[model samples]
Target: MPLLDATATHPITLPDGTLYRDTVYLKNVISHPRMEIGEYSYFTHCGKPEDTAEILAPYLGHSVRERLVIGKFVQIARGSYFITSSANHPMTGFTTYPFRIFKPETFGYKDLPVKDTVVGHDVWIGHDAAIMPGVQIGAGAIVAAASVVARDVPPYAVVGGNPATVIRMRYSPEIISALLDIAWWDWPVEKIETNLAFLETGDLAALKMA
Candidate 1:
């Protein structure tokens, strides 16, 4: 089934097979490209008619694109901000402060390094969360509402605050690694859609047996 419908003039940016469960909604998805949503993900109230996951695509200008690379069973309440190029600034100048003052003309930060932001499966990024550029949220991570994530999160960890810090770990390393190795989420789309019933029952082992 289609995760979200699109207008004839505006197509939803989701890739060929994006599954869903519980409550999931993506209002508009134009300009968003290479989108890959997972199970139980609900993204609502998209910004701008033209804004899309493609917003993450790199460009040569002062402005940067917005990105939201969510994973399976994510509960992103509302107003979660994900910026792909928010990290770069003019590094050549004597002082980085000057670049901020210059606004659009900060030329020194050209070709700034870029890293892909990864959101792990079974993540619960609460409402109004702001995931900074280059942050990789590990699997089963929980980012509390209104928290600002500025660093990498470990698997099954909980983080919250302005510059979110790891307050706790939700699982042992062994289990987390086991789940990662299982990688059920990476299964082919048609297989998932066809075997939806088995998955609903939580018997992922069936995938292994098959």
Candidate 2:
């Protein structure tokens, strides 16, 4: 019902720069400390979106929005850095000795032209990881801890590295083929609830397997 209880056991405050187009899309089933979070989402013990200690781990930036974009059912370990945007230096012909250095950011300093950090549903980011800007992490993907993601990840894929590389797909192309055909998650809630057991464990060899 209520997203948060003002009387939290510990300090909890609304986070800045975190926004959802629709509030109904945000859900908080558990509340203990003060943190800014999104819906159908739960932060891990150290998953506080801001402080990483009392609150969800925060980034180095002045605005939290430039750091992370989490999707439904994500589990991000502590000390993860999502650098969605930064002081991108003008490398071409500025000739200003150290152009990399930022200069009192102008009109475009606060927000990126395209807010492009994304995290898909049921994804898990391990401890001490970093996600870079303009990166789109696909649904049901797993990013191992201590990895660095630099490119786009495909759905249900697993990636890790200094510049994250696709180690492999979670499921064989065949298995995924059937699962896609069934598209069980799209089923009505009532239907899914009734068939949960089969969907969760049944090995789809195809046909009735689906």
Candidate 3:
């Protein structure tokens, strides 16, 4: 049997053989116009499945210009959320407060510079981590628990703390480049399954050959 089922809403089965409903394949649950989610990207949240997109990105409205693009195999732990560019208040004026938001007719911040928030493939975001607007987290990156990521995260880097400084790079630049070239997340499931040993064992030579 295949380990991954793209159609499954509740993908995780606990050791007791009960379905773990808190975890869902994001692509199946999210139907937001401003969001683009890839396959096998699961998010663990206690909220209703229908509200997954809203819960994950509260600031992203249907008419918002900025998008939230999350790539394949992203594992987002419980309470992690993204704050998109739409949430930013205008900074050019004297006050940061949004006066225009109070009135329905006048309510607008459309002129504010908006940039899409992107999460690359095979990324793992730990519990309660918050991704700031316009931040691009690269492939194979790990954002630690309770992090507030305000800047771009490099590929294969482990980051943590407020503003999310890089704790360390998971591999040397050469290896990282090689892995990016391999891009196993883009492979067919059968090919990925066949090469699982190399991936898990960090056998670069074997992976290259595979």
Candidate 4:
């Protein structure tokens, strides 16, 4: 049997068997490349068209510039925005206005600082949240609603607020370590399916036995 039902029109199966669809409202209106969505990761918009997710500031005409990488089983809620580039104008000059942006001869794309925004496995990014440029979110982190994350978030942390701050760790270090070692997201589909109950119960022994 095929890992994906390719006959579906909207959400297509990615190479890793993840069901993915671009934010339909942004199609043709925006320049985002098709995201490398990991297995079982999906966006929940709560039926609001205005709530959307896209790669921020994709390079003009497929030039391989955007480097946002979201990992397996990442749950991104509606209205979450990932800032992919610094795009800071030459701030050292007298005026902040980007004179270089309009002047082709003066334009220097390389002068601006930009980096990848990487979301690790099993991350939960909340509604209307904004992930700032170069932020690396660790595995199993929970970013609360309306948070603006500007820095790196450690694994299994519960973060909230604008310019997000860590509220607490989800588990003790040992449990978090064990979970990381297990890396359930890397398991085969069949095995994942069979062990679904263990996820709810946090039955590490059962999962290990399987």
* Top of the candidates by TM-score: 3
lDDT of 4 by residue, 52-157 (tens): 4333332322333546677877777767777666344566668888776688786655666566778899899888898887789999999999999999999999
Root-mean-square deviation of Cα positions for candidate 2 versus the true structure, in angstroms: 9.1
Residue range 1-210, candidate 1, lDDT tens digits: 643232222323446544322223332232244244554554443454344343322331234433446676555665675766555555665755635435656544445566667787768888788878778998778999889999999988999999999888875786567667776666655666666676567554674554
> How high a TM-score does candidate 4 get?
0.75
**Residue-level lDDT tens digits of model 2 in 56-141:** 32323443334355665466665566664543433445452443233644423333243457887667888878777768887778
lDDT of each: 0.61, 0.57, 0.95, 0.69
* Model 4, global lDDT: 0.69
The runs of at least 3 residues in candidate 1 whose Cα sits more than 4 Å from the true structure, single-residue gaps closed, are: 1-30, 33-40, 46-69, 97-108, 187-210
RMSD of 3: 0.9
Clashes of each: 3, 12, 0, 0
Off-target runs (Cα >4 Å) in candidate 4 are 1-35, 45-61, 64-66, 92-95
Compare candidates 1 and 3 on TM-score and give the better one: 3
lDDT by residue (20-118, candidate 3, tens digit) is 999999999988888999999999999999999889999889988989999999999999999998888889989999999999997878778999999
**Residue 127 displacement (Å), model 3:** 0.6
Q: Which prediction has more favorable lDDT, 2 or 3?
A: 3
Q: Candidate 1, 178: how far from true, in Å?
A: 1.9
Question: Candidate 2: global Cα-lDDT?
Answer: 0.57
